[model samples]
Target: MKKFNITVNGNQYEVEVEEIKDSSTSAPRIQHQAPVAAPQPSAPTAPKVEAKKPVVTNGAGSVKAPMPGTINDIKVTEGQAVKAGEVLVILEAMKMENEIMSPADGIVKQIAVAKGASVSSGDVLVVVQ
Candidate 1:
């Protein structure tokens, strides 16, 4: 004879059975169990209200990536003069196109990202002076 532990649904069980020999032996003992329903997790009571907006880094003569994405377009080049609010680059993130704008009127001193380059949030994309 042997003992075994078993689980059905959420309940546990311990059962014993007899071993039968091959020569003119009797039938083996069997056990059956019905499963009980398991406890379900509760759903959230409140839904989310707001999503955080991306950071705008258009100050101190440096422009940074607001989110992780690929550089789809670069509208300004090094040594190019740009006006405040001028669109300097286009970024593709989450299937949306976002324009990175200049914060002040200044000359573009450097462009840190190339077209089709991938950048992470807060990565420097441009320098103005």
Candidate 2:
């Protein structure tokens, strides 16, 4: 009888075996084998990230967001004349297209949010003068 201990998958196992031989049989042959290990692939590297600064608007006629949403489009450009209640920016919030209208007749002075940009409530969208 022969006893052996083997390790597999971080576990240890004990086993026993019995040997049989016939009187007419020749001597047993011995063979050697080497254990093989599978190759491991390396992990993927993450992309580099950079910090962004907050946008600040200090204009007296700045148009601000009413709710958190993504900017879908800018209807008016800088120096473009706009009327009160005219849609100046398209904001997508709660899966709805929200039209950001001009508060009064004015000219667009500056735009703060870009298309597809996420915005917070009260974030500046455009400056009117």
Candidate that scores best on lDDT: 1
- Computed on alpha carbons, the lDDT of every model, listed in order, comes to 0.82, 0.78
lDDT of 2 by residue, 1-129 (tens): 686666678455565554776567666655433443434449866879764222333558788888899999999889999887778889999999988888778899999989999999999899888
User: Runs in model 2 with CA error above 4 Å?
Assistant: 1-59
**Residue-by-residue lDDT tens digits, candidate 1, 1-83:** 78776766657666777766667856566775444445565974576776433335756788999899999999998999998
Enumerate clash totals for all models, in the order shown.
0, 0
- Per-residue error at 87 for model 2, in Å? 0.6
Task: Enumerate residue pairs that collide in model 2.
Answer: none
lDDT of 1: 0.82
